[model samples]
Structures are given as C-alpha cells and as structure tokens.
Target: MTVRSIVKFPNPLLRAVAQPVELFDDDLQALASDLIDTMRAAPGIGITAPHIGILKRLVVIQLPSAAKPAIYVNPSVVQASTEMIRHEEGSVSMPGVTDDIERHARIRVRYQDLDGNERFEDAEGLLAVCHQHEIDQLDGLFWTHRLTRLKRDRLIKRYGKLIRAS
Candidate 1:
C-alpha cells in the first residue's frame, strides 16, 4: 500500500463530483488500500478519493482503531436525524483549521465493502459525522460550505492573509 498525497482546498479537483465505482477489480481494491494507508499516514480519521485528486466515490475511515478500519465505496446516507449535534471538525485538505459544525447525530449509510458487497450500517457520534463529511466530498461539498457565508468569507480571508504572511 502507498500513501497518496492529499490535495488542499481551492483545488478544482475537490469541487468536482466523484464518479461511482464501476468495476470492482484489483485496481479498485488497490486504490481503497492506498486511501486507507494515506489516511493512516496522515493520522486522520477519514479521507475521500477527491482529497487525493481522484474523482472517484471512495472513502476510508479509521476513527478508533487500526484493526477495524473502514473502507466505504460509493457510500451514501440512507437516513439521518433531524436532531443535530455539534462537533469540532477538521480536515486534511484544510490544515491548521478547525470549526464546530452541526451535523446529524445518527445516520444509516449504505455502502459497499472492500469486496464490493452491499452493506448497510447505522452510525452515531463521530462515525456518523465522518460518514456525512465523506459523503459530502462525493457531492463536491466540504465542511466549509456548510458554514454561513460570513464565516466562510472570514475563513477565506484568514487563509489568504496567512499565505501572504508566509
């Protein structure tokens, strides 16, 4: 397995909708493995294929353990709660920034396992949040987009100022 480099924000690739996984072959499996390795190497809980500049609907999440790391291929939220929960969320693409965002506390996701078998699981807490976040990537959306326009403008200004300072 190899660790792929994650593309940062403002990259056009991150804005592009990901293509669904069509052929479940060794190449696809290797890509999933690479995603897991990349997430582990970055020491983050989750990553999407678009983060690596691959416009493919794939995501790897290893929140609490290395042993039971999850690979979600073509994942989608089947159900979500109206009652929301707030959590401090960060991203590999937007390093050095974190923000509290409201998300569904519980969700049911339908996705394919490593072998491309269909699976559905109910997740709550961090897992649910992670699922929503990664699925957003597939739709070409990020956590920043979930924020208010004023907040997003401030974040952009901060990033621009920091870049100039550096």
Candidate 2:
C-alpha cells in the first residue's frame, strides 16, 4: 500500500468523466489499496480515482474514528432523506477553502466493496455527507457546485489567483 498524489482542482482530469471498471482484477484491487493508503495518509475521509488522475469510477472513504475504510466502485446514492443538513466541508483539491453546503441527512448507497462484492448500506451524518461528496467527484462534480453563484464565482477567482501565484 502506498500514498498516491491527489490531482488538484482545475486539472483536466478532475473534469473528465471517468470510465467504469470493466473487470475486477489484481490491478484494480491494487489501485483500491493505493487509494486507501493515500486517503489514510491524507488523514481524510475520502479520495476518488479522478483525484489520483485515474479516469475510473472509484472512491474510498473512512470517517474519523471508523475502524477501517470502505471502497466504493461506481457507487451511487440509491436513497436519500428529504430533510437536509448544512455542514462545513473542505477538500484537498481546494486547500484552505471550506464551505457550508446542504446535503441529505441520510442516504442509502449501493456500490462494490474492495473485494468486488456488491454492498448496500445506509449512512447518516458525516458518513452520508462524505459519501455524497466523494460520489460527486466521480461524476466530475464538486461541493462548490452546491454553493451560491456569487460564492462559487468568488472561489473560482480565488483559485485562479492561487493558480497564478503558484
């Protein structure tokens, strides 16, 4: 297991739609393992294939205090609560930038586990929020998409300035 580099925001890969895993093989499993290691090293709850420059539908997430991580291959939300919760969230892609976003308080997700077995589970609170956030990355979406247009514009400009500085 090893930590992998996270592709930063505004990178073409982050916007590129990812391809689905056609077959579950050793290589795919290794990628998953690497993703887990990277997420752990990041000390973060989630990481996606696109974040690592792999245009494949893959994501890993482990909440704080969770015993182990969970891998989601082509994961999607199957159910979501009508009630919503607003939480402050940040991402490695946009370092130092945090935003309050509204998301479903509870959600049921369907995805393949690390072993490639199909799994279905319900998640709430931070877990559900993290799941949705990572899954959005798979779809080439970001938490900023949920922000107000003015805030989104401000972020884009801020990121642009940061990019210019770097």
* Highest TM-score model number: 1
Evaluated at residue 39, the lDDT of candidate 2 is: 78
Q: What digit string (tens of lDDT, one per residue) describes model 2 on residues 19-58?
A: 8777788888999999999877766778888888898989
How well does candidate 1 score on lDDT at residue 66?
Answer: 47
Q: What TM-score against the true fold does each predicted structure earn?
A: 0.93, 0.91
Candidates' RMSD to native: 1.5, 1.8
Local distance difference test, candidate 2: 0.85
User: Which parts of model 1 have CA positions greater than 4 angstroms off?
Assistant: 161-166
Scored by lDDT, the top model is 1
Task: Report lDDT per candidate.
Answer: 0.88, 0.85
Worst 10 residues of 2 by lDDT: 90-99
What would the per-residue lDDT of candidate 1 be over residues 1-166, giving only the tens digit for each residue?
Answer: 9999989887878788999998899999899889888888776899998999999999988887447678899999999998899988878887767778899999999999878899998999999999999899899887889888998888877777766777
